[model samples]
Target chain A: MLKAIQNLGSSTTTTTRTTTGFVASFYRLKPPHATTTSAFVSISSSLLSYYSPRTRPTKPLLFLTRKTLSLEPVRAHSTRSESKMDDTSSSSSVAVQSSGSVRKINFCQWCGGQTKHDIPDGEEKMRAICTVCGKITYQNPKMVVGCLIEHDNKVLLCKRNIQPSFGLWTLPAGYLEIGESAAEGAIRETWEEAHAEVEVVSPFAHLDIPLIGQTYIIFLAKLRKPHFSPGPESLECQLFSLDDIPFDSLAFSSMAVTLKLYIEDVKAGSRKFHYGTINKRPGTSPSDTHGYTLVNHLQS
Target chain B: MLKAIQNLGSSTTTTTRTTTGFVASFYRLKPPHATTTSAFVSISSSLLSYYSPRTRPTKPLLFLTRKTLSLEPVRAHSTRSESKMDDTSSSSSVAVQSSGSVRKINFCQWCGGQTKHDIPDGEEKMRAICTVCGKITYQNPKMVVGCLIEHDNKVLLCKRNIQPSFGLWTLPAGYLEIGESAAEGAIRETWEEAHAEVEVVSPFAHLDIPLIGQTYIIFLAKLRKPHFSPGPESLECQLFSLDDIPFDSLAFSSMAVTLKLYIEDVKAGSRKFHYGTINKRPGTSPSDTHGYTLVNHLQS
Candidate 1:
């Protein structure tokens, strides 16, 4: 069901690794239609503009170009059964039951009665409605909360001990609980995953991954003390300087984007809170697959 | 099933009218345990501090105090059948199926099969599990998006044509769509409810009413032009200056608090975006019932 094609270049070639555990060759595909511009091409164009020859060296620039373009294919399958499999391969902590399996809500939880999938009155979409109780069940996006803890120019990271990216590094984050603020949830998750105590400064990023039906609210926090250890959910916990970040082994795309933004903002001497949405678009190639747009930019 | 107990004052008794058409007398009851603090008392205390005498005059203060406190009983019944009735009295546009009845989901919607009301595997809450297809049905909080549109020193207000608060004025807002950003949802709802085109300035308020399972995200916006008419959901649409706002006939509690905060900020000569949460607490008196807390205050 999965295949990797390598396009080798003379003297210098860039390879990117995906969650599928295969390295794919980096190549830009021309737009199939003349009038339509693909998101992949736009991203690449922007990346080329962002990493100009006057600003940075060539080696790291090539690495970043490959890394950003690699997100397309994984995001393309985000709404399909293949996407579920990709998610499982990347992070077993998600709530997907199985890959390539049909999900159907056949029973009503309120009365132990049969249900029918149909559109309810005054609603735009189809829902699981109970035949006996006349109650319509709604499924909303789940919220994931995490913190970007900065202590003496180092950011805290945790290595997963569980499936879905076993041994892969990630920021301390998890599903939000009921009856708690987003900031509170982020703080709690940080403590639970990395055993770190940190005070949240403000909301840093709000990314909506609609394909997976999850919204991530990340907060910028200050470490209370330099003390830290791995919690039950983590294999190891440690702080790393900006230069030592494992960009390739990161568990999620949102984390990578956030870290990159933070680094860029710090380098520019203007660090601010950012809120944006990440959406995956249908495209012909991996490079043209995903679109990340910043809707609101606020400085704190 | 309905009773109203009035504690008449000697000569000047205050009577409050509920959306249910009941004119209940306003009276304060001490907590059952004097030493123990209920959410209601805490809210009242905080409200007293928030509405200190130094900020404004005490004439309209009584009405503000009464309005904030009136949320207690409705919130108290939010988890019960009576709460549904209260909601029907206030706004009929909500997604609740029935009023004054126990809601149950008896049948499964996915496969038209029987369902069991039980906790699914690896979950903390009980859900409607499917009998045949084995899908767990999950219900989550709905997102309510709206805009606080300001133009020429006036804010837009819409009179609701639907039930639950028929004829009561409200800010243009509605349930958010699955695949749209919160700001986009707010803008769409504004157009749908008031026939107005607005450019969103920033997120102004985020109120979580877990009692009714809703999180409201209200944005501060500016009207593109002075063009507006009543939409299908609205009976009338008009702009109201700060002095002309109808606090007594507003549809929801959060709207009242947002307006109040806006006024207070304007008065303090610091007109900036505010992000906060409003929580309703169980109170003894209807006028001392709910609390609003500013968890994170940032000036932008």
Candidate 2:
């Protein structure tokens, strides 16, 4: 559900602002000025280390390797049929679709020319080929970057006021914006969701929810302070200790994995990078991760 | 340019293939059948360790913290204007464009409803909104996953027969497709560009080429075998020792950063994960990463 927690304003209270002559100009097509960045970013760690060349390297440690991660099978990972509620991003429609109904591309975004599904020269898959411009529309997975912040020995959780998971608890994470790094996206999501500041300690996990075409990059972080508030997308925000954490109502399988890993690391007193996948089971609420199988690369 | 090294068949030589009712049946709308994955994946490592409960955790190492990886201001990273030739992805037109001419969204890609740039209610940025369906189109950077393979004390490099960097040297990498993990994408790219299978040793570098809205995930890998040939996207695949690498003709600033990190680690006799940004100098060839400044998070 990451796409930066997507579409903040309620459609009912809506007012459409226009730009580019057809609409009143609320935003210039030029991106330099972000009209929506309300939260100021302040972090504790230096995500950008001003480069000074150094040669010393330490002893190499153990590294995990994956022999083959196949994509040709029935992808048993989809244990249940996906519900539309699971994906709320407007952009999610650009790619992967339900077998029952795929969003057909009838026109090209590049040239506005009528398009049809056809394999172009040398290509193997059917693409939305523009008859006029002869261009193809390509879609891929989106990256959701966020942080798992620890402050005062507690974890921050947002009760989503948003539709995707409605009232479930989730980490402050969203789509990684253009021209931004994973760390920047993580910090931004934290601010936008919880109205709290955080400094990224390290990237904790890069988990792929391939069924939904999303890659969640969660960073281990610390609150800049103990203060926080709920942003537009959240009904409320609260900090909870391990015992009080809502394991059952967690929003996404990715979130559950992250929190569990954090708790494991917390108990073992170790922190390391994890790469893996979550195979979601069918007929479960979007918030429920029970029965989901996790494939963690580091452990293997 | 890594959208799977983009369009493999030369347009002039491409034979328009079709599926569905309109075109020749080369593929099905359903994805289970990958009409194009020709190579068999053979890996030396286990990408997915089947999960098992474990109690003990390893020692936590020095974790680099990044205070703020900012996204405001002029974004000094673009020391020069980027050339369109650098991006060969058909989907590149979906988002991020030259200041002179941005791609206009005239219709909703979902419903083919005529669209115009407008700020939806509660949102600040002007999105291409479908007047009929009342939907929005959002775009984000793409993920490029590839690997740095060490085979017999030499590294693998592909001579691109494809554009954006034809004739230049590059590591085997391409766009991370939907329903694919970063490691799988890396291995797939290795097979596609070099016709060589590799086992991902570990995630080596994750660098964001934000200027182009790209995040490159490079893994340290060992080729499954010494045998390899150029795939469709490459003119020739070759192995080069560190001393013979074509430093100047290397394609993509991100590639430069990845290789440099690999070389540095090689000399130091240690392998570590790296994350950072590459500020590509303007007016320079896409392959020419000279004068570029690298801000490495881990090194910082």
Candidate 3:
């Protein structure tokens, strides 16, 4: 088992072992996610460790008992293993159960598949397995991440080589890689698509796209050297000032939202971190009771 | 097929189709990743989608064309199916060979695991894929998030539930969930373990924990309606003033680092936001510069 370990805060190690007892390691750990400021309140990883994959059923019987007695109802697992081979455009239902207490009858919450393993085991928790992936699907939020690469007075952008927007221009951004820090992935992505050597400055934006099942953290970074070339993943690479941004040609709604916030920050001469993505357009204040709706867009 | 679609900013409909033809749509979509910010950014499913369960070589080409010839070197794939039952403890290697291009091996630059994947024929741009999970892994940063639940001038504290210093006392905090927004998750976590609802007043502390695959984002929230019960996640929950904090029993190296910063900020009256977690600590800062070193304290 080769182990690649990077320590954050202090010297600590995390090891993953292969049968041959090989270990791999990584270093200079930074916080996985951050805002414009890296100064966050301290929270330990004790509780987080409970959710680790290696976490066993410590008192499985107690957990089972709690499962059986919970107020929620468990449905029967009704579907079989049949690959939903149709195009993603084709509609199909395969029910998958979530590990959590909540269970809905009609469909799997995450993938919109039919509920297959909705069995009320001795424990009250109903398990719905997805007919498509054969794994239990639950309403889990997706991870979103991206980088803000600034060179000179302009920002670098890429015309996506993939879809849902194939040829749209945007920053180098994507989802968080498992066991990777958001900053590391962001910098890595910058290198991959834009072929640029960059230094992550600070985390700038954090937003939640509830509609699409993602949470995003956009970071501010500067190119170590301005020289760059487009990678296979990018159709084109170029830099643009705030006014010259190709607004209509940007990919995904969130990118547009982030860019808008970035421009606003620059205009206001404020570099503080901002929450809520353009996708959700969180109301004016975090403590407001407007019930998560947009009152209006602040006209530039 | 049940579809969970959100409202598109433009006319683009957030439509999801299931394998079955029945689609149930939600008018107001849930935030993508539990947090109230950011949209989900995923790799282009169309261009990058490969090695599906149904992947099969079609009819051999009769005449190789220019574009096909250009892409020929990328067609090379390992004939080995993903090993489902191999001993996970053993180290492995994955190599991609194209006709004329240099053969590339997929492994972690840090731990040397067979967890790297070439990015769709791109050179020096492959993701580290975890062999055990058969998914790509990145040497990423860790996230450290926690809440500041204060009552009267005193704040809440708890002994470590699990960990390096299991009985150490500190403020309640943990990792961000898979699909949760940091603030929402932080607040929800405070209520879950501390049985308290606190409005996060200002950004507090941010620490980059690149070493142990962690980052810390601590929020300074004010307590509201203090009546509460300690959930199962905590060992004990109590309130303490700055003078009353148990520095000796604090959990995790970062907690002391955070508390010091917190106190510094409190004293300086700089409630806006701080940059690093333990910049005040000299010895602990090395891991911050060199990445986290894994320790055995995490083992159950």
lDDT of each residue in A32-114, candidate 1, tens digit only:
12222433333322112112232222111111122122122222121111221114122111232211011244545456566
Ranking by TM-score: 2, 1, 3
Task: Tell me the tens digit of each residue's lDDT in model 2 across B72-123.
Answer: 1222121111121234122334333311012256667677788766545644
TM-score of each: 0.62, 0.68, 0.51
C-alpha positional error of residue B138 in candidate 1 after TM-score superposition, expressed in Å: 4.1
Backbone clash count for every predicted candidate, in the order shown:
26, 17, 126
Which is superior by TM-score, 1 or 2?
Answer: 2
Cα lDDT tens digits for candidate 1, B1-300: 011212211112233322211211111333323322433322222112112233232111111113123223222122111221114122211222211111234444455556665645433334455577665443434556788888898999998776545677778887654444565567767877887877666556555443344556677777765798998778999899999999878766667767876787668875544433344433322122122322233222
lDDT digits (tens) for residues A129-191 of candidate 3: 545534332223334566777667688898877544567776887654432346555665666
Ten contiguous residues with the weakest lDDT in model 2 chain A: A43-52
TM-score of chain B of each: 0.63, 0.66, 0.50
DockQ pick, better of 2 and 3: 2
On the 0 to 100 scale, the lDDT of residue B182 in model 3 is 59
Compare candidates 1 and 2 on lDDT and give the better one. 2
Best by DockQ: 2
- What lDDT does each candidate get? 0.49, 0.54, 0.40
Q: How far is candidate 3 from the true structure (C-alpha RMSD, Å)?
A: 21.0
Runs in model 3 lying further than 4 Å from the true structure = A1-143, A178-180, A277-300, B1-144, B161-165, B206-208, B274-300
